[model samples]
Structure formats: C-alpha cells, structure tokens
Target: MKNSEPIIKVDHLFYRYEKENVLEDISIEVPKGAFLGIVGPNGSGKSTLLKHLLGLLKIQQGKIQLFGTEIRSFKDWDRIGFVSQKANSFNTGFPATVYEVVLSGLTRKIGLFRFGSREDRKKVDHILESVGMLDFKNRNIGELSGGQQQRVFIARALVSEPDLLILDEPTVGVDAQNVNQFYDMLENLNKELHITLVLVTHDIGVISDKVTHVACLNKNLHFHGSTFEFNALKERDLSSIYGHDVQVITHHH
Candidate 1:
C-alpha cells in the first residue's frame, strides 16, 4: 500500500436492515496512524458502520476499501484485529487461563489441531505485557476484573500483530479508574506500536481528547474532521447530530 493511502475508505455508503435504513450515504476516510473515534447516540448506525468496515455485514450500496483494496477482495484478515462489545460475555466460566486466551489469537496461523510454538508463546507474553496484563498471565480469565479482562481480550487481538485495531465499546463494563487506564493503554499502543485505531463509542466526552480524528454519525455523517474542529463545534451543531438537545463535554487526562 502507498504511504498516502487511507487505511479505511467509505464512499456513498448505505445500509438497511429489513426495510429500514440504518445508514444513509455515509462517506469517511481513516488514514494511517489515525486514532479515529466514531461517536453517536444509541441506534445511530455507529456499530453498523463498524460492521461494514470490518466486512461482517454485507454492503448493499456504495464502496468500502480497506488498506487500499476493495472490501470484497480484501484477503489480509491477519492484518486487522477486532474486539467486539460482546467480548465481556465470552464464556467467563470456561476453563481458560489468560495465557491460553491470548494464545488463541494465533489459532488461524497455528492451526486448530496443532499447538503454539515457542516463538508463538513469546509473542503472547509480549502482547500481554504490552497490555499490562502479563502479571495475570496464569490467572483464570473469569477471575479478573472487567478492566483486566478487557486488557486480556486486547492482548488476544494483538497477539497476531495486526496493523489495524478496531474496538467496539470496549469500555462498557469497566469502572471509571480503569476506563482512563484503558484509554491510556490504547494511546500507548497507537503511538508506540504505530497501530491505527478505530474506536466506536457512545461517550464522546471520554474519548474526544484521546482521538486524533472524530466522526459524528446519526443515519448520516454530521461531522468528520480533526479533533480540534470537532471540539470547537458549538453545542447546536452537536445537537443536530444527536437529533435532540445535547451537550458535549471533553475530558483530558
């Protein structure tokens, strides 16, 4: 891919479930090294757009390109890591250690019938360390706090060393203190590892200061620009995006 190409590109996108339109003529671009945050009220097509970008949902209208290739033809699945909102609900009672959970990320590369090699184990350890969960490597996944479990899931996503990481409401069950720490960890990953991040969040205030770019969506994209521009927008403009009276409050750590 060229250095100037966007990591994700969407043009004139539209999606419908049954007969109801969830997304309408959406167009956006996420460039390399971008910490892009997609924020909107509930049922505003935030997750729907994310699903389209990840190729989890069929595109009925418009075009989407990932890493300079059309979404339909993009074959480099290993280059992208995804952590869904339902990650926290994964069989918490299952008999799996943190190490085992993260190691599973390589199942596609290591093969289902085979075991991870020494180098694979090293990679898992390194990823867990990066997420600050190495100390809990041997603990049961079900025993950790919500934030710790989320970090483990992130480690699992990173074990494959993806170039792009997409997270959907990853901070759902995390407490206030851990939520801040979680975003800090993501920022470190973006800056130090150079992994492009696409985060879907409903709490715009928490992520506004952490992201490099912001896109507000409600059936259509209301705003797409630098974080500075997004922050400078008046409440009236933001209210329009929510389709109701609203206020945006940004928090900085």
Candidate 2:
C-alpha cells in the first residue's frame, strides 16, 4: 500500500435495508495502521459501516476502496482478519477443542479439498502461543471462561496473520480485568505487529484510553477524525450522537 493513501477509504457511500435508508453518504479515509474506534448508539448503523468495509453488504451508491482498489473487486480477503460477536457465541456443548477452534483459521490456506498439513499445524501452534493460549490448546470450548474464550477467538483471527484486524464488540462478554488484558493485547498487536485495527465498540471508557482516532455514527456517519476532536466537542455533541445525555469522562493518553 502507498504511504500517501488511506488503507481503507469510503466515499459518499449509501445503503438501504428494505424500505428504510440505513447509511447516508458516509465518507472516511482511514490511514494505514491506525487504531480506529467506531462508536454510536444502538441501530446507528455502526455495524453496517463495518459490513461495508468487509464487503458483506454491497454499497448502493459511491465507492469503497481497500488499498486504493475497490473493496468489492478485491479478492485477497485472507489479508483481513475479522472476529464477529458470533465467533464467541458458538455452541459450547458442540465439543470443539481449543486448538481446533484456533486452527479453523487455517482453512483458507489449507484449501478445500486438502486437510491441514504439517506446516498449517505449525502455524496454528505459533499463533496459539502468540495469543498466550498454547497451554489450553486441547481444552473444550465449554471449559473456558469468557476471557479465555475471547483469547482463543483472537488466536483464530490471528492464525491468518492478517494485515488488518476488524473486531466487533470483542470485549462484550469479557470481564473488566480481561478487558484490560485484551486491550493490552490489542495495543501490542498494533505497536509490535503494526496491524491496522478497526474496532466497533460502545465501551467509551476503554477506547478513550487506547484508540487514537474515533468515528461517530447515527444511522448516518456524523464525525470521523482524531480523538482530540471528540475531546474538543461540546457535551451537547456527545449527547446528540448518543440520543440522550452522555457522561464523557476524559483522561490523559
């Protein structure tokens, strides 16, 4: 990717679900390797914007570019890692082992017809270790706490070693202690691995501390810029996006 251009760019994008218009002319330029937090109230189309980035929902108007080329036309999706709220919500009684869950990410590299080769297993092992889950590799999914389960999901997401990672509500089920740990892990990934991260979250407390950029959306995007912009905005602006009175307690980064 060129240094001058955004890694992910959305231009005047519009979308409608059934009869209601969901997103209206949203545009953003996310520079390479930025930790971007997308925040808004419920039903504000935050997740819809993420879907547009992932190419799951097609844009009815304007354009979306991943590394300058249109996202809809890009074929090498393996370079992007996504861990939705569904991955952690899998049936615990199904008896999928931890290693198996993490190794599932290798499916793309192993191809459809062939089973996982020795190299794929080796890669899974490395990823499991990187995510600090090597010791629990054989444990059943049902046995793990929410934090452990989230780490396993992250390992699965990292098994592909994607250049960009998009996490939708990664800390929802996790406890406060592990939420901090997860945020620490993300910071390490962003600083050490230099992976671009786009996070969808409502936990403004944690995000304000770690994320450098922010985007506010309400069925339609309202703001996209540095976190400092959020700091400068009046309390009324925060209330406007939240659709109610919001208490924005800030801190030093």
Local error of candidate 1 at residue 194 (angstroms): 0.4
Candidate 2 per-residue lDDT over residues 1-253, each given as its tens digit: 6788888899998888888988898998888889999989989898889888988887888899988888878987888899887535767686788888887888777765454878888888887887778999989977887778888888898888898899999877787667777787787778877888999988776567788788888977788888777668887888888989887754333
| Deviation of model 1 at 214, angstroms | 0.6
Best by lDDT: 1
Model 1 Cα lDDT, one tens digit per residue, 152-175: 999999999999999999998888
Model 1 spans with C-alpha error above 4 angstroms = none
Worst 10 residues of 2 by lDDT: 244-253
Clashing pairs in 1: none
Report the lDDT of model 1 for residue 89.
Answer: 73
Candidate 2: Cα lDDT at 237: 86
Candidate 2: C-alpha lDDT: 0.83
- C-alpha positional error of residue 4 in candidate 2 after TM-score superposition, expressed in Å: 2.2
Error of 2 at 80 (Å): 1.1
